[model samples]
Target: MSPTVASTGRVPVTIGAMESSSAASGGSTRREATRQKLYEAAVTLIAEQGFSATTVDEIAERAGVAKGTVYYNFASKSVLFEELLRHGVGLLTASLREAAERTAAEGGNKVDALDAMIRAGLVFIDRYPAFTQLYVAELWRTNRTWQSTLMVVRQQAVAVVEDVLRDGVAAGEFSEEIDISLTASALVGMVLVAALDWKSFQAERSLDDVHAALSRLLQGRVSGCR
Candidate 1:
């Protein structure tokens, strides 16, 4: 599960699949909390300092855990970062899926579902800017031990947006001329970059303001009346 940026001032977030597996493994709540601290510290430091520049001692100090605790949860810094990527991306995918499914259940049209997802994306980044920052920086960087895993996790989230676009095209809600896969990737990129930009440089802007901007962008993409 991705750690929410402490600066978002939001409640702690679930760690998606990581929570379940760790629980079933008989890991105690104390261990989980320690791991959560490690994740939070790691993402923030790595986001600011880059993976290699950040050290286990720094992570431990940030988390208020000992250096030994970092080793207890993860064998190496790379392993912790790898699991952090999985947990973070897994939560993102889950959020998108939830937004889409819930919108559909509420009788929202495909376009509405897509809009809800866009808002979800915004909320996610607002709550986890550190993770978003780290992800965007490392996404295209090759030669990293976890680069392949990161790509897979990224595709999982993109696939959610792609499915929405695909459905819209099938129902004629979207232009058939649209390339759903490419558009999906573009949409994901747009939200991530926009959220990062807003959070970093436009702190005065309301979340709704950012959401509305992206929503307008998406609406403009439709050929017919939205």
Candidate 2:
């Protein structure tokens, strides 16, 4: 999210939002715009149909670009998909980090940071449902070429949650014996799956309603017995 390269040592990929408005020059700006179009087209096609079923021709057609342009931007479909994953998840990671930092700047506790991150995740999923669907679907598929890249970006997002959990434990806000890694994963999984359900079946529900329900679960206030 902070433009850190994966330790895989391939190349230092700059992780940022899929859409960029601050390109330094006209050529860079045009290239970013073209890449964004390709990303949007690919996400939609891959979400509607499986990745293997989608082709460069379809992506080019959907993006209203020539096949040569796809090649010029990305060497192959797999590269495009991998970069797309990096771009989309990078944006999500940045948003989560910003939420946590903003809460802390306002004198909020770790719990408040976690709550803000939950809202950030919901906002991201709501804005980019198709990309979210594609990302979640690809998370468990080991055979994909982009699996390693997905894992790296996925950890970047989860590590943000884990950092808050670790801080909470240090401050005695969370149980000392709690498993930070698994708990972070579970929290992230909860928001992702719940948000997907909200978008798929409960399309009429507002974002605040969904966030409120998840917030209760996060704060462990679901049961009325207490």
Candidate 3:
């Protein structure tokens, strides 16, 4: 999936939610908390300064941990970055999947599922703008060490939207001539760019305002007659 940008804040919403779920399930809560800190620090620092310009020492310092703690969690700065990308995107994929599944369970149609996923994407971006920005920037660069990892996670996220589009076509809810892959990519791109713009340029606007505008577009009301 395409990534975007925003300022870093507390632990990302999705990640924090995942951590809560994991903790309830008897998972390693402490480790996850530490990783969350590192992820937050890395995203902020790397987003502000390019990945190469950011160092393990700086990440550890920002995270309020020793440099050795960084090495303990990740073999090197590159490994830490690769895992950070995976972790953040993985949470995003889960959120999208949950939104789609929840919509289906509620007897919503394919369009509804897609719209729900759009909101999920916006929420994720709104929560972790710096991470989104970092992810998007890495996607444009072909030389990154984690480029392969990035591609895999990206496809995993986009595949959720693609699946919904395929279902829509199968059910005759969408035109068979429509390109599923491209349309899925387009929908994701729309939310990513729109949400980034909302966070960066139109910070005064509420999420509901952005979602309503995008929902209108999804419902084919672009002419504003409906």
Candidate 4:
């Protein structure tokens, strides 16, 4: 006969493990949802009223969160804006990265990858015109904190572009002599200019037309054929 022992008072290991995992996942999901809502509110307010005129309280209200929640997630208005800028940049970068990955999977040329990246940027800017205005407004700001934060976010995109450009050069699809850093910055500037111009003069131009022209510009292509 097998000897039977009394059950311990502690919870079962399997049940305990499941409960912990569920609690952790639920907490993470809630945090992410809250953060997303806050980000959306911040973008909408900044776009509508410009960054300078927008207040943290307004963002909190718009997000349907207590003001303390905003402070809890972001230390200050500057930090909040920095996060917003990062989020916007992330959206564009992810779009570009996805396009690049897809092109690579199909064994497409580097120029195709680069063009897709540029087109992704154009699509993002066109979709977020007001955010573009806020971004440009921040360009002239003299605040040291803001400047540093912008530099950090700008570097993130620059690094991504540099990696892609380096790959293009390695594959012999792009000129090795081209300055990757300068070219990336120039490409970014062109996107900004085209997007701003299109939004500033909505009646005169459409985003699709601008994106087509800009894509060709980035590709160094013209009707005359090299």
Candidate 5:
């Protein structure tokens, strides 16, 4: 399982099982730090110029690590990006799962769980804008080497939303006519696009403001007028 952004502090191993290869506690910490740096560098470059344009050397330089360090941690740039996509999306999925579980534990309904998942998505995007941007851009494109791996990761995250929606439908909170899978995908898309828009084009709006807007839309309070 990939560690959360908060727990792992935003980065780690790829290209191989380098993260867990070290058994010494001190060495493991250092290795984890190096991997994090590399991930941070890779995500920024890939998000800016894209995976094809970004190189290992550039990632190493941006990470303040030697070229061999990149090789030491990851087998290749593709592996690095693959691990990155897995790790980032894994964190998002885990976050949503925890939020849903926590909400349910607190006697909240599936609608509340869904709301928590949406906010969790926003928070994840806010913390890892580069990863979110890269994923959003690449998600619809075809023929990429990493696309298949990413699809599985994408499904894991979306499944969290689908679970909550399914519960809502079963409990009569949501309409039986709702297509749970489609609605879940739409909700995930909504959070991703809204977060990117807020970060890229709508700097004046606060995160709270954006969240409120999304919450209203989810609660069916927004008018359908175009």
Candidate 6:
């Protein structure tokens, strides 16, 4: 049989898959945490001292990892920055997915679920402003790898939102004629743009205010008249 096995009777087969996954997950999580620390250090230093002058050595020093460790984790400064962008995107994706899944499980409608996701994204950026700033700064860079990775992440977000909208349409809560895929992406884009612009306003406004604004915008744009 394959190395990975599905469970059967009480004590019939092997636990290799479980062991392997546990080990792999442990290793991957440790590495990911290390990489995150280095990314945070690099972003912090770059934000403080400008990217042109922020050396990888200083990042390693601040992250308390060896210089070679940094190199092993990321090929070079640019790759490190790329991974930092990926990390930030990954954080937002995870948060959005969890919130959307929870909302769906609770029988929330598509528009309500999407509003929760938008709020989650705002909260993620608020919680990790340094990482979010790094991502925003390099968003328009012409780096192909970064561009492709971001596109993939954005596509995933669009796919999830599309699924939610399609479900809503099936449940007679949304307009079936609407292009759910494009509408979902457009909704995400609107929230991202608005939240980026509203970051400065966050100091004076609460998250509830931001969520309410996004809820109104999305409900107006995507909600059915039923």
Candidate 5 on 10-71: residue-level lDDT in tens? 33422222345565654556677778778877888899998888888898887788999888
Can you write out model 3's per-residue Cα lDDT over 1-226, one digit (the tens) per residue? 2222134454443334334457457867676666767777888889879898998889888778898988887788888888888888888999999999999999999999988998999888988888888887787678767889989989998899899999999999998999989988889889989988888899999999999999999988998764
- Name the TM-score of candidate 1: 0.88
Task: List where candidate 6 sits over 4 angstroms from the true fold.
Answer: 1-34, 45-54, 64-66, 140-145, 221-226
lDDT tens per residue, model 1, 43-158: 88898999989988998987788999899889988999999988888888899999999999999999899999999999888888888898999998888789899889988998
The TM-score that candidate 6 achieves is 0.71
Instruction: Assess each prediction's global lDDT (C-alpha) against the native.
Output: 0.84, 0.85, 0.83, 0.71, 0.81, 0.68
**Poorest 10 consecutive residues by lDDT, candidate 4:** 10-19
Ranking by lDDT: 2, 1, 3, 5, 4, 6
Tens digits of per-residue lDDT, candidate 4, 2-97, equal 112124242111100112234655555566556656766777678678877889889888778899998887889888888777666666667778
Residue 140 in candidate 6, Cα distance off native in Å: 4.6
Q: Where does candidate 2 clash, by residue pair?
A: none
Pairs that clash in candidate 1 = 1-15, 1-87
Better of 3 and 4 by lDDT: 3
lDDT, candidate 6, equals: 0.68
lDDT score, candidate 4, position 53: 88
TM-score of each model, in listed order: 0.88, 0.88, 0.87, 0.74, 0.86, 0.71
| lDDT pick, better of 1 and 5 | 1
Off by more than 4 A, model 3 = 1-14, 17-30, 224-226
List model 6 lDDT by residue over 1-226, tens digit each.
Answer: 1232123222211111112234645456566556656765777676556666889889888777899999887888878876565555665776788988898899887777877888888887566655555555655567555687767755665676777788889989887798877787688777776776676555667778877888877767557545
Instruction: Kindly give the stretch of ten consecutive residues in candidate 1 with the minimal lDDT sum.
Output: 8-17
Q: Compare candidates 4 and 5 on TM-score and give the better one.
A: 5
**Model 4 CA deviation exceeding 4 Å by range:** 1-24, 28-31, 65-69, 139-142, 203-207, 222-226
